[model samples]
Target: MCNGLLNPAQYREPQALADEHALIFARTWNFVGLLFEQEAGQHRGVKLGATSLIIQCDKQGRPRAFLNVCSHRHAQLCEQGVHRGPIRCPYHSWTYDREGIPAGIPQPQAFPEVIADKSAHRLKEFACETVGQFIFVRLSTDGPSLRDYLGPEYDFLLHASAGMNGLIDEFRQDVHANWKAVIENSLEGYHVPAVHNQTFMKVEGMERGHQAPVDTVQHPLHSSIDHPAAADWLVTFERKIAPKIGSWAWRFPHYTHHLIFPNLTVTSFLGYSFHIQRFEPSAVGITTVHSRTVSVGFTGQSPVGAKMVEQIYAESKSFTERVFAEDAAICRAVQQGLECAERPAVIGNGIEDRVLHFQRAYQRCMNPTSPPPPT
Candidate 1:
């Protein structure tokens, strides 16, 4: 009769899921949208996995993030339109100031002072910090500052920003695969040679040449980040990936930051920058990815550099599309196999460690009060 059975122990403990998220998302900094694009008083909305938030700058131009809903009506304050005026919920017309205070309310006579508790009713806030063009937000009222949360990864972002005054171009790719699968692929570089073999994989593993990072989570099959040679086919390809570019990416819990969260990935070649977010759910493994891209040099750049950069970006986009198509095919197959119990259990190798780390983060955040997952 179509049992609709789910093996929770093997996947997660439902009760502990929220608590686990509190542990992970509460304390860890979440990457929000870029800070530079929005003008002073400008507001933007972002959805991270399941949580949706609206970000706005204070009078000082500093950025802040809060749950977009109004306290009284439980209606979204930030409408679909990005407005510069005070945030107002269309449902009841309740309004909040940029600092997230209850600035105004329609038909106020109905409520007494004790019920308003303006401070408590204001839009719920989370701690946030800005660096360069990026913004980082933490869910809990208490946690380490965004700077400390980044650890050594901060250096990687700084290095990527050295040359470009800011981002020049941006792009996002949508894939029909699980968010976990998409993130794990980003963390490991094992597929570069086999999957991206045509245009990019052809490059030599040298700075002067072309080679993507190798997947390091696993041993035996693991390889070091490609160090390329000049005048080689790889160098030519690297020019396409990004010439005069310093690259760095990190995989954190829930979402991974390229360079740094909020920075909007800036690949030096042609100044191509891409900022992305992915949402997932247990009921369905499919993930929805949203991306924003923009041209960095608001002032513009040299013709020679621009031409070569555009060429590289075009080729890179082609290669990225093909590789992701391959990943989607494989992940869909994996999901189908699991749903059907095609194989009772699957063993993981070193490369699979990234997935293992993801699961652990999920478990730690989920806090499944239930039994352990299937072996």
Candidate 2:
């Protein structure tokens, strides 16, 4: 094994970053946002590596995605998400419906040739699909279906996200780091003691608390980690809300972490909450990370008067925000260290198996000769 590490040059080179965009981001199912983020008749602009897309729900509430560039002048239709109606080009009022078919033109008489073949000039569309409450887009037309690409781990993620609805919150910030640094930080729990010692360790009582060792399951496209809560937390929860908690803890058994190939990292926390973190690489050493959360309840609406459930949900959000902040800091620090030639090449121990797994999957995508890892 090469320790599943990329050299410092690989991390800093512009061409390598471009290759990553072409090989990985262009070809995979990238988590965009929760379905609730965009409303019917409204469009949201999202970027996947180098591709820009517009995700909108039609008047009939059907989801659609199109290249954000206008077909006529090639100007971006919208810089940011807008609420109201059909997408209209600011330059000439050229309008398109949710299906990306040209709907209107400022003056049909002025451009007979353009009007004669509107279909030929329709906005390009991308493949869009939803898993649970999350929306994902594939920049390329060809690839395995999102479900097949996700493989068996898709079901586990679906079950863990059952009843999840509208996004509760999302945190976005550009980090001065390579995307791999952010991905590596998320894939391994080994940094919890050092990077998150005061936050997660103190909160979970894992600093000195006796807890079952975390267990992990690996797949070609994904890997998951299941961590049991601290013994004291479980005992107290059982005493207070055993019936409400029911078989959830037993069935779920862990605060699971899944690093979905390409860009999404999802975590199921406390059996009632899940977070999807997307790492979007903007340049060789720049990444934009978005951390989003959703509530697990019927119809994306929180139940009324469920104080304990509310408490746990609120606490989970607070905990994730804190942990994410810690992770972002360390990822940036690692990015800085990676620029030094004297810095040691990366290596993953058993506890960082998911990190290795991610690197393997990434290599398979970026290298023509690298075999796809076992699914």
Candidate 3:
């Protein structure tokens, strides 16, 4: 960002990363995993910042998230996905129902007081919410509602990801760079022409492609890129599926990229296809990236139409992974460059304003004393 780059210590210092994990991510609604990816009656593990959690659908099929630790001995429960059954703690076999209620104990008579007070012994739950099948959890006790946090941009993101099919293709990479660098790389198109010269440049062309003029707008809790061709490539794809699944018209110059503060990137691929990416930091200069392409409102098509859509989805997924590989390598290099005792701040061209906005948001979160961006 041109305003002020984060100090090298911010990326290299363990203490700084810890503060960010707590202040920036844990306090906000952090996107975990897609709700649709999990089975109706099962438990799946997910991590947000430093907290490991278990997400499950109740008997009535409502989604819930709780700390993975068991109440008995605080042993991690359900390390992986498990089918319909009580969540039994491996340490003491204390069982929990779908609602995370303590259902059974080996010697119920011995601990009558503990058994009577079910609420205290139930799974430790975090504030959980969902937006268009994507699940988010906040470890902090209080904060703005997810809807309030997203502002009007919530509708914009919902439109982009509303009916995404089960995750079809996913590409995860352990990026050896600070999570912020990964996010900065995702926000700006300035590096596309140069960094993605071969992969993305081949399709969109040098001018009208990824390097094309980007009109960026910043909101209170999020920012977006207004790109004309965001939906152009999907015009044909949408038309083909329109007959089977009625017309789904999206506003022109559709959203090319949308960044929800801390860590969530929702980008439009074609008509109703969206790519969701999250940059999660595990430690200083270490991040785990989760990228997935899901089809929105795609279902009940003829065999031929389905096959064609699958082909397009696979091809596009491959292209995206290749582009991401390029970006990840560049981010690592940028991280390595930050090792200098004092480095020149990165100067973003006007086109990279989104990066500056993101940094501003990051600063606001890390240091609550700073003024927040104008809504």
**Distance from true position, residue 121, model 1, in Å?**
3.3
Query: RMSD (Cα, Å) of candidate 3?
Result: 3.2
Worst lDDT run of 10 residues, candidate 1, spans: 218-227
Q: Model 2 lDDT vs. the true structure?
A: 0.75
Q: Give the candidate number with the greatest TM-score.
A: 2
Clashes of each: 30, 0, 0
lDDT of model 3 at position 34: 80
How well is each residue in 153-218 modelled by candidate 2, as lDDT tens digits?
Answer: 677666765666656677787878899888878877678889888777776534343654564545
CA deviation > 4 Å runs, candidate 3: 1-3, 80-84, 204-212, 230-255, 298-304, 372-375
Per-residue lDDT, model 2, residue 171, is 78
User: Can you write out model 1's per-residue Cα lDDT over 34-113, one digit (the tens) per residue?
Assistant: 66666776678765434678889887788988898878868776653266767777788777777888778777877667
Computed on alpha carbons, the lDDT of every model, listed in order, comes to: 0.51, 0.75, 0.75
**Which residue pairs show collisions in model 2?**
none
Write down the lDDT that model 3 would get.
0.75
lDDT by residue for model 3 over 1-375, one digit each (tens)? 344546777878889888987798788988877877867756787778888888888877778889899888788887644445567788889988888988988988988888889877888888988777777888899998888888866687666555666666786678989898888888887787889988876764123544355655547458887665545455654576545544333434444778888898888743457788988887788888888887765555667766666776787788888898899899889888876547536756777778777777787888798676443
Highest lDDT model number: 3
